[model samples]
Every structure is written in C-alpha cells, then in structure tokens.
Target: MDLMARVTAVVGGVMVMLQRVGAPRTQAVGTKPVIPSARKQGIMTLKMPTAKGWASGQLPKTAPGLKVNAFASGLDHPRWIEVLPNGDVLVAEAKEQPNPPKTLMDRATQATMRRARAIGVSANRISLWRDADGDGVAERREVFLEGQNQPFGMALVNGTFYVGNTDGIVAFPYEEGETRLNGPGRKLVEFKPGGHWTRSLIVSPDQSKLYAGVGSLSNIGDQGMQAEEGRAAIWELDLASGAARIFASGLRNPVGMAWEPVTGALWTVVNERDGLGDETPPDYLTSVEEDGFYGWPYCYWGGTVDDRVAQDPQMVSRAITPDYALGGHTASLGLCWMPAGTLPGFSEGMVIGQHGSWNRSVLSGYRLIFVPFENGRPAGPPQDILWGFLSEDEKFSYGRPVGVAIGPDKASLLMADDVGNVIWRITGV
Candidate 1:
C-alpha cells in the first residue's frame, strides 16, 4: 500500500475513535444518530433520557401525544407477559436456582454449570396484575400459581391456561378476572431440561395443536444430533388426545413463538448457537414448517456452516431455511402481531423484542422491531419501531424487553422488562 494512503487510513481510524470516545450525551440533531462503524447498519440505539421516578426504577416517558405508563411494579423476577381481554395481565416470575460449587469435576462441566446459574433468574410463579378502575395503575396484584419449575411460555385456550415449565408443561382452568387457581395445576407434557431454558408455548391458530420450543442444552455440537437429551427441537402436542411428537428439529435456542395472523403459520424468534467469534450464527425469525430442520449445532442462516461443526456429515443434508435473519447475538424474544386496523401503519407487520445480549463485547438489541410483511410474507429488512432502551456507552440498561403483547385496549403495546421487574405500556401518539 502507498505510504500516503496508509497515513490517511490511520488518521481516519483515529478520528472515528476519538469522536465516539468524546460523543456528547445530548440527543443527536437529526432524527437518529449516525453510527460510524459499518456494523451499526442504518438503525441506531440511543440511551434512555432521564425521567421522574414513579416507582423504584426510571420510567420511560413518551412524547407529548404518546402516553407511557407503568401497569404494575415491585414484582419478583417478571419475564414473559400476556394481557387478557378483561384488562388483566399474566406475568411469569423466572425461577431462580441455587448456585453450584465453584469447583466441579472438569473445566467444561464447571463452565456449563456457571453459565446455567448466571442466565437463570427468579420467576417460578405466575402473577396477575389487574386494573379495575381504568386508572393506568394496577390496584390488585397477586400470585396466580406457585410451586412450578422455571415456567416461561404461557397460553390461554378455551378457558384453560397452559404454562410451560422447564421440564414439563402444565394447564389450569382460567377465568377472565380470577386471580388464583382453585385446584392443583394438571400436567400436560413432559420433556428433559437443558442448560438454555427459554421454552416458548403457543397453540395453533385453529386451536387444534399445541406448539412448544425446546432449546439445545449445549451451544453447538454434532456428535449427538438426534439424541433425546440435547434435541433442540420444536414439538407439537394434541390438545385432546394428549399426544406429542417432534415438529421441527435443529433449532439452537428458539425462545419466542407466535402464530402469524395472516398466514396462520408458526413463527419463532431463535437465538442461534454462539461462541464462533463475533458474527457466526445469525439469530433468525422464521416460520415453523412441518418436518423442517433448522440446522442447529451445525449450519445456520441459510447454510452458513459453522467452522467448528462444519465437518459433521449429518448436517450436510439438512436443508435449512429462515424467513428473516437478524444479526448475531441479538437474543430475539417475544413476538406478536400488531393489532390490525388499530395502528395506521402497523396492520401488516409483526413486532419482535430483541432482548440484548451480554456475551458480545459491544452490546446489541434491547429494543423491539417490526418485520413488515405483505400478503403473509416478509417485505424487507426488519425496521426499528420502539428503541432507546440502551445507551451507546453500554454501561447501563434501563430495561430488558423480553415479551411483547397486544394490549387489551387494542390501541397500545405492553412490554415486559425482566431486569427492572415492570411492564411498560407503549401507546400511539
């Protein structure tokens, strides 16, 4: 390379570094901040502005016409959330486990146990938050169910509420405003538990089948592809007959699942296998086709084979497909269809919450995005809808959005912040 060209490149790199290091905290002049790195793409992440404290943590205040309110607070380890038609909300308090001993049998085993403890949080019970008076505040907050193992996914079907536990599935009879269950919850399905325990539960659009996602125990492997333990597959259950079978396999960590309204197809937000450097396996938002293999523990993002597991002969034939793929380590979660005809421009799109990741050096996600579709298919790249949950500095995050649910009013969106233990209500301006 020429000496002058090399000198210019070095100076430009130094200038970009200095600018980012000394960037002002004030809001950027234009609509969105321009990120100098090619990795930022077009979307920008902004730090949440200061606001008056309502409860314990900071509340995100919306613009003049846009109203931001906290539905409930002071909960213990709240995670995935669901809003009922009668203005009641159901929240899964993540179940916490006791920390294991520092010294283990081997280094690999100890590392696995440590990661398991770090990711796990306290939410073994379900809590119901009800606002009887239309006051934007919840007056009644009570536990709906207890003694359940690390439950995450939840669905209400024909007056029956189903909960997805770490190792099994259970169902309870649910009334519109009832806060507690009368009898013990009945077991629906049972499965082996793994390290990554973000199981998502959903039923078919016609209410005929129950769909559940089981993430892989290990990040990536090819030795035990079809083994019963680290299966990393999506399953379908017969609601009436109590029968269950694998629907799709090779998904690393399918955390969020929702049935698309327009296509009536199951769409999942999957966190693909990590540890292959900065950008190896891209987390994907894709439809769950029958008997499909998503190439986990081997291939990812449209046959982009992993260098670690590429030599596995079994993965060579598994044809993989993804509708839309987000960048690596975004930790996509909780997807829902925007209420049709309610918001002017969101009728034809789906909203997904990208629960930011901590593994990467520079954190990404911590916002909800809209993947627009036309005639029941993806239109283009995913667009940022509600962001500003994390700052560019990456030191502090106000809230980690894990769940997205269309509100009971049909005019607003409810996001569950697991870290802050609160539910944020976002309304149109």
Candidate 2:
C-alpha cells in the first residue's frame, strides 16, 4: 500500500480498538482548571496553505508520536457523526439541497425537471456503522432514519437522538439495536428560514438546554436587523418545557459548537459574514457568553466597524468582539476539546476541523488542526494534526472533514467527512 493508505490503515486500527472498548457517553463538562493568571496572548495564529486534492495514497511527515489512517468511505453528504454507547457511529446525512426554488408547473416545468434530474438529490437518511476491527472498512452498515429534509447536526443525550435542520428540531427514541426510525418522532420546535439556514446543534452540559446555531437568512439584505429576528443567534431551547429563546445574537453564521468542560463556557466556530473580497472579517472560535452580542452587521472582529452596513450608534455599544479569530475565510467547523488524559501535547486543548473554503480564489483549510491549551484555555496557534487530504493541484479535495470526537480508548481520533461520506481514525505512533 502507498504511504497515505498505510496511514489510513493505522488510524483505522486505532478506531477498531476504541470500538471494542465500547465508546463511553460520559462527557467531560465543567472540568476546566481554576487558574487565576492564565494569559491570553492573541498573538499566535496558524499559517494555512492553499488546498489541493491529494490522492488517498500520499502522507505527510509524522510528528514524533502521531499516526494517520483512513478508516471508512462511500458516504453521501454525511454531516454530524456521533459515537453511540454500543460502539456504533450515528451519522446525519443532509442529502437534499437547501431551499430549492419551486417552478410553476407547465410543459416548461416538466422539461426543466427532466434536465435537472441528473443534478438533483435523491437519498436522505441517517446511517449507523460498526467497525469490528481497527482497519478501515465497516463491519456493518444500517439505515437508522430516512426522509429527513436537510438534516445537518445531531446530538444524542441519554438515549434520545436530537436532529437539526433548516426548518426545525426533531427527536427520536435511540437504542443500541434500533436501526431505521419507524415510529412517530416528536417535533421539538420550528424557526423561520432565510439567507443562510443551516441549524447546527449542541446540548448543554446539564442536558437542560439545547443550543441551536442558526445562520442569517440573507447574505446581506434590506430587511437588516428585522430579518434577523431569530437569525445569526444561538437559540436556547428548554428540553423539558420546549421553550425557545435567543441565546446569543449577531454571530453571522455559527456552524460548530462545544461546551468547555473546564470553564463551562460555550464555544462556537463561526463562519463570518462573506463578500469582503477574500479576507475581510475573519472566521472565529470564541466563547458564547449568554446574551452576548457578537456584532454581525454592525461590527466585526475586535470591535472593527463593518463598512457594508452602516453601524447604528446604539448597536455598536452592545456588541462584544470575539475571543479569538481563526483566520480569514478559513471555514472553521467541528470543534472538540482534548480530554485531560489523552496524548501528551494536547491533553487540555482543542481540535478544530477546517472544512476548507469556497469563496476564495485559492482553496484553504481541508485539514484537522490542534490548538494547544495551558491551564484550561487555548495558549498557542493551531497545528496541522492530519493533512495530505488536499492535493497539489487545488482543484478538488479527496475529503472534507466536518465533525470530530475523541475515541473511547483515549488514544485515537474520530473524524466525520460530509463531502467524502467517510469517517477517519487517527492515532499516535
């Protein structure tokens, strides 16, 4: 096998070991260190390379004790992936296109449907898989649910599976052997969709609140703040009462989120406002304080006023700048904190998946990164943990990694790729 294939095999092996151990659902929330003088330098940043689609056989040089692997393949737009208590991976595949325009029915409409049939979508469902051994191929594949309209993010809390889409939130009874959703599921809540309608979800550590990340309906529009009634904010939903309220506002488009175990702070990976040429307002990973305004149209990173939307003097005073800016157009998504017992360098750190960029003339991201932490917070720049998925040509990428979760064995990493429809495992040498 080639070098990349070899790495993939090694990573896959580690995953199999984790699966054998029965991936635990015991979360590490509110375990952050209580340090008084931990400094936030805001100086270090990642030097990103332009992305190109590399073949599956190539590999990057290893970092002392690190090993890479390609575990599984052949998926259709797999978005959020979670490891169940029974060693199976649950994946939400948002198969259909978002907000497709409906053409008035006529002879012309039929003709258009015929022409669009080649490019249109068909399969939309949730999948479950088991990897018996640590190698790449899954031993079992089963469909858990079907007919979901653009299902993106998923959270499994105490045997209850919560799925998020553009329109609303839904929940279903989850068990180890229960594949293919048949019974009537409960609809949690609904929201108005607009310009950007991807709803990413994360359940609070206490399991009392469900924080859903809603993107702005329009790119930039005349509706302005009014169109943003529920847009660009992290809406907090009470799980028991089913009450929905805006949690945080003016985030533009917060895609991925995780609760910091040590500090109990909510951190979100934001895909900032686009259309500033290539690099204007940078994408970010920051603490989502309750009721904190992030300055969507009025201000940007570090209190810089945006020229596109003239800032109202009143809104300016309300918006707080981000904690840390990842980079301009980096497309940062899927963040996870390294547990206290995993690895040497990244024990108390963060791992962010850069899904790569589309708006730029040159491609970027498409790699897994490690953000070092000291005490309980991020201390340095994000390092490339798993690369080589991008090639030298920059035309296409072999994989686009989305969600990331640490394996149960405490030694390997589990990554979900929506574009390639595969899950990867990474281990240390």
Candidate 3:
C-alpha cells in the first residue's frame, strides 16, 4: 500500500516486542489463587513463540514416575479427540479460518496467530487410530471422516456418531468395525460460527444427550450483546427431539468439559478475558450448574464487575465464583477424568491440556497437568504430567498440549499436541 502505512505497522510491532515482560510466576493454581488487583493495559501484551515442530531427537519431559512416547505423529493440527466403545480413538485435525484483519488490532492479532500456527486452512477432517491387542501405541490409522467445517470434537452414542463442527452439530450412522463415514451428515443443531470457534463435545453418561461448548464471538461483548446470542456457554442437546438449550451461561470461553465422577456434576476449564494485565482474572476450572451464571462481560470470579462493559448489577450479584483458578492466560483447553491409579503418584482427578497463551509476555500452559480431586472437587495443588514443550529461552514452541483423555486400556494418558503435530501417550515407568 503506502510507505507511511508500512512504516507505521513496523513501528507498532516493534513497540509490542519492546514492552514485553517475562511472564511472572503465578501462585494462581488452586482453589485460592492469589489474584493481583486489576492492572489494565492500553495496549494488550503480545508475546508468543514461533511454532517449531519437534526436532529429530526432541521429546517432551515427563514427571518422575511417568514416561512419554509419540503415540502417533505427522498429523495435521490435531486439537480435539474422542474414544469409541470398540477401543478405537479419533483425533480432529483442525485450525482457525483466516479471518481478514479489519483494524490495526485485528492485524496484530492475525500476525500473532500465524506465528503460533493457531490459524490456517483447517484440514477439516478426523482420523482414527487403533491399538488392537490393548497396546499403548496405536498400530493403525485411517481416515474416519472428512470435508467438514472446522470440526473439533467427536462422539459416538448408541448407533449414531456426532461431530462438533463450527457452524453446527452433525450426525452420521455407524456400525461396528467400520473405518469410515460414507456421506455428509445431517445437521442436528445450528450454532453461531467464528470468534472462539472450537466446539467441544461430550455425551451424557447414559448417552441420552450431548453437551457442546460455544465460546464468545468477541472478548467481553466488544461486538455488543446481540452478537453474542447463544455464545459463551455450554449447551445441552436432547437426542430425541434434536433440541438444544443453554445449560450454563457467562463462561467466556469454556472449551473442555468432564463430569466429576463422584458428584456427577459437570466441570469445565474456561479461558478468561485478556487486556486486564497479566493475572487479574486467572483462567479457571469449575463445576457448572444448571442455569448458573459465572460472569463474562459483566463480571468475573463472582461479583467483581468489569467496568468496560455496560453495568448489569443484578447479573453480577447472581454470578457464581469458579471453584478453582488455573493461572492467567494459560488457555487451558482440554479436560478429561482419570480414575484413581490411572497413573502412579496420581490419584483420581482431572487431566488438563493447557494450550498456553499469546496475550501475555510470560507464557503459561504449554504442558499437561493433573489437578487432584477428592469427593468430586478440586483437592490440592496441581502436578505436572508433561513439559519441555517450550524451549529454554521460551522463544520457540516445540509443542503445545491440547485435547487429553484416558486410553481405553485404562492405563495410559493420551494428549494431542497441535504445535508439534503429534499425539503423545503417557504411562507409568
């Protein structure tokens, strides 16, 4: 375009890099994270490593009593996963659609996303992995489904398989031992697409309904409340009538969901808002209640109002505080329940895949971690399951953990690493 515009863009990018600060170590890891007072920034922090897949001898570090191996590699950005009753596993190779930048801030965001490999042409496909003989390593891989609109999560209930595509939930019939879906599936429910576009899916224990996570279209109603209709919440879908309703509200970006085994309560990991400094409102893990409001544009952590949005006192008063904090800008996106003795040194708890962050100078959540549980609630401090995804200087990401699940063999942990384009399997040493 023009010489002046080019110069202005370069100057703005340089300023962002110069203002970067090391991510401060956070104590925001438990039911009582020490939250600092609000310190908003006129220009949001923007620091991220360029995406570099694992080098020839490179691998992630694991906890002392555990070991990790590449269960499958050379996959497209595999971000979400599902396991079937027949012991097969599925991983969705998806990425963000390239939304053209409309403003200066949008241009900056677009560039950051590109460096992080969080944006690109999505494969728009799902691949199946199999480890017959109950082995930890997958011995077979096949195309299970393809040609979908940025599909993320998958589920198989009864005889129908469901997919959480960006614009809608789709269904296809399946039979035992089949390796692929035959046709374009029928849409079960329509949803607003784009923005925080990953739609994660989980079925009820009894297989009667499915729950999907739809994140907001903008950070804190920047596009106004009307643009956020039926967004930023968990939706429950009835299988019989094909009906869906908001199960919980105000969960800015709830990506991963699991049921607390003992209490049977639904729990989720939510990514909180940005531009409020490094650690004002920590990303969190909390049990979601029916019809409960947890505060998004209006408030956070229960009654703490966000003055950026138009005030809504009554909604703020009714906001529910999350049960535990996971650290600021960690982008904790994947969650799955692991029963007691699933791994050595770890008891029953949730496995979280922290997708990490770009809005903060200091990085958080490039690894996998376990949060201990007692009687179906967060019990104590978290423990690392895998690390070393980031280089020592933190300027390059070899991998970033995302979707997590327990293997059908009931002994190993499976993690999807989008940055490295591999699926990792962890088991006791």
Candidate 4:
C-alpha cells in the first residue's frame, strides 16, 4: 500500500478501537419520544462492516408468519424500485456518480466509500422485471431505460415517467405495458450538486404536483448557505409548468417519502447528521408540513441545539419535532405505507428499509422494520420484519436493504439490497 493507504489503515484501526470503547446510551428505536443529547465532535468513530456476498442458499431472515425469497437476482447495484400499474417492477441499477477527490478530507471520504462498496461507475439504466406467474420471482426482464446519469427515484404519472437523477429530474414518454423508452428524456428541473446526491421523487395524490427530496451540499452548511440554495429539503414542482419551489427546509438528508393513506399527509424518513456520538439526535420518521423546518445543522429533534453550529434561537424555535425516532445513525432510507390487509399483522403501517449505519460503534439498521400506525400517525414500537443482513459476528454484512415498495397485488413487500445486488420479496406465510 502507498502512503495514504497505509495512513487510512492506521486511522481505521484507531477508529475501531474507539468504537469498541465508546458507550452508546439509549436503545434507539420505536415510536416513543426520545430526548436529544449532543456529544462533542472530535474523531469520527467509523464502524462500517465489511461487505460479504451471501453464501449459497442464503436468504434474509423474515418475521414469523412471513416468507422471504429472491424476486430478481444478479442486479447491478439496484438502488431503488418502482412498481408500475401493470405489475412491472422498475429497478434503478445505479451507482454513485463520480466525484473525484480534491482535498484530504475528500480523499478520506473516498476511502470510506471504498470500504462501504459505494464507489463505482454509474450503470446509468433502469431494468424492468415481471413476475407473471406470481411465484415470488421475476420470470421476464428487460432494460426499460438506458444511458442516463446516476438515477435513483422513479415515478409514473398520467403515462409520463419521471426519473430523479443526481442533478435533476427527467421525464420520458410511456405507454402501459411497454418495456422500454425510445428516446432520451427531457430534463424537468436542475438541482444543486454537492454532498448528498440522491433525489427521491414522488407524485401528489391528485397528480398535480411532484415532490422531490434533495439533500444538502455539505453537512450543516459547511459549504456556505449559497451552495445549499435548493437542498436539504423537499421541492414541490408543478407537473404542467415545471415551476418548482421549496416545500420544507432544514432537513439534512431526507430520502424516502410516502403519503399517509388515511390522512393524506406527506411523510418522510430522514437520515440525520453524524459525528454526534452514538445516541445524540436520532434519525427520524415524521409528517412533513408546508413551510416547516426540521433542524439540521443548528439543532435537531425539534429545538435541541447542536453546539457545533451557530446558534439561532429564532430558527431553532421554528424547527418542528419529528413524529418518531428510528435510532441514531440508522441511515433510514426507504419508506412505503402498507395498505389495509396487505400483509398479516403488518397492515395499516409504514415499512422503512434501513440501509444500515457506518458512523457508529454498534451498527444500527441494515434491515426492514414495520412501524404500526393508528389514526394516521405512528402508534407503536417498530418491529423488525427482515433482518440478518450482517454476519453472525456483526463484522461483515451479507446485504444492506435500501428502497422498499409494496407489490402491485399489495400482498408482498419488495426490498432493494444494494450490497447483495438482489431484490428480495416478502409475503405472508
């Protein structure tokens, strides 16, 4: 190894030691309220488990009364899934866009990315998988769209297919049951490029508006507020005119979003800022309100001041408290609501695919969890539905769950395991 490589190894070893000694307070899960406790920022306790492919005949463990199987195997880093009206599953086989290292920190970030298996050339395509036999596996597959940037979120409205690229939203012409698009798509809107790059897109129930989740350019506006112009919040776009406006602000890294079925409220699962120890401001699930701000750099968990940033009492006061905490550094990403009677013992709730954490000693997330809802809000403790992504020793991971969606029949759940390069299907036993 060269100089930087050797340096990274030494630093990684020290970090692992720190993680072993760090004491994380509080069990970070469930719907119950949690108190925010900020820890002093210093050495980052990096604890990413090494990625290990699944062994032969290996599968994720499911909850009781549920069965797990591979929906589509051998995908090229599938990151997101969109179930079409005709029962076709659209998977974005994308990798992170190339962001060359410019500084020492950037180089270190690149090294971390390598350890997480997050660095690679973009596949720049979407694949369509069809399970005509309902046998929990896709029998037919085709390339639906190709030659695009790093695409993540996808949505179809009024026969117009929308894709969320790292830097913008694009739309393509579509017809029911058609396998592929004939031409490159038109760019709907451009976004600022920086730290967090995944753009998650969802359409309004009335199909009149589009909501795009854009993350911040840097952690806590370290790159200046001007660089964060249209980031760290959700954007509302008019589908007809393409006009867009910021719907909410101060969200650090909002990823997965869904509309609450009973209340029609907009909901999101946010991945909070790290370097706050293990138990300080937890990642959260909350209902998004128009013009509301959830504290990012300055505060967290609704008004708990993060001494790391400049204090603004007024801004802190405006920060809205999240509805439920999903534990600190869980990296909670994918969100989808389970309709009534969709799955036994899991109906009328939200399922979150936690891609897992890399910033804490004790690894959190890395599985699928179900949070029950009552009267249109989170009402009970979270139950793990899919787990065992990590190895028995917890030092390596067989897979990490990302985007999740309910199947067209609404009787099964689909999860994108980026590390495993497989889409897993879960159904009632």
1-429: candidate 2 lDDT, tens digit per residue = 334334433443343343324322221112221111111112111122222323567554335577766555677766676667666777777643434445322222223222222113635577887777846446788888887766777787887888886778889987766766766478888876535656788888888888898888754443666767788888999988888999998888898888777788888888876554334556778888899988887777646666667667677778886766665556787788777556544556778887765434344577888776675567766677777555666534666667887765566777876555667777776
Show where candidate 1 strays beyond 4 Å.
Answer: 1-57, 61-65, 95-121, 222-230, 310-314
Clashing pairs in 4: none
Candidate 4 error regions (>4 Å): 1-10, 19-22
lDDT tens digits by residue: candidate 1, 1-429: 234334433543343344345333331111122212223211122112121123454566443445567787877657788777677888888843534534322222333222322244455788888878866678898888887788888888899888888887888988777888756688878877656776778878778788888888666663355444535889898998999999988788887887776777888888876454223345778888888888776666646565566456566467576777666567888788775664545646678888766434345677777777777777776766666566546544666678888777777778787656678787766
Between prediction 1 and prediction 3, the one with superior lDDT is 3
Of 3 and 4, the candidate ahead on lDDT is 3
lDDT winner among the candidates?
3
Q: Indicate the worst ten consecutive residues by lDDT in candidate 2.
A: 35-44
CA error at residue 94 for candidate 3, angstroms: 0.4
RMSD (Cα, Å) for all candidates, in order, is 9.1, 12.4, 2.5, 1.7
Q: What lDDT would each prediction earn against the true structure?
A: 0.67, 0.65, 0.88, 0.85
Return whichever of 2 and 4 wins on TM-score: 4
In candidate 4, what residue range of length 10 has the lowest lDDT sum? 32-41
Q: Provide the lowest-lDDT 10-residue window in model 3.
A: 1-10
Ranking by TM-score: 4, 3, 1, 2
TM-score of each: 0.80, 0.79, 0.95, 0.96
The list of candidate 2 runs beyond 4 A from truth reads 1-64, 95-122, 133-137
Q: Scored by Cα lDDT, where does model 1 land?
A: 0.67
The 10 consecutive residues of candidate 1 with the worst lDDT sum are: 27-36
As a whole number from 0 to 100, the lDDT of residue 207 in candidate 3 is 83
Per-residue lDDT for 1-429 in model 4, tens only? Answer: 346645665786687567556556676665665544566547776666666868889999989998999999999888899999999999998876547788875676567666667766778899999999877899999999998777889999998999998889999989999998868789989987647888899999999999999999877787777788888999999998889999998999999999998899999999988887676668999999999999877888887888877788989989998899999888899999888687777758889999987677677889899999999988888989999999866767899999999986789999999989999999899
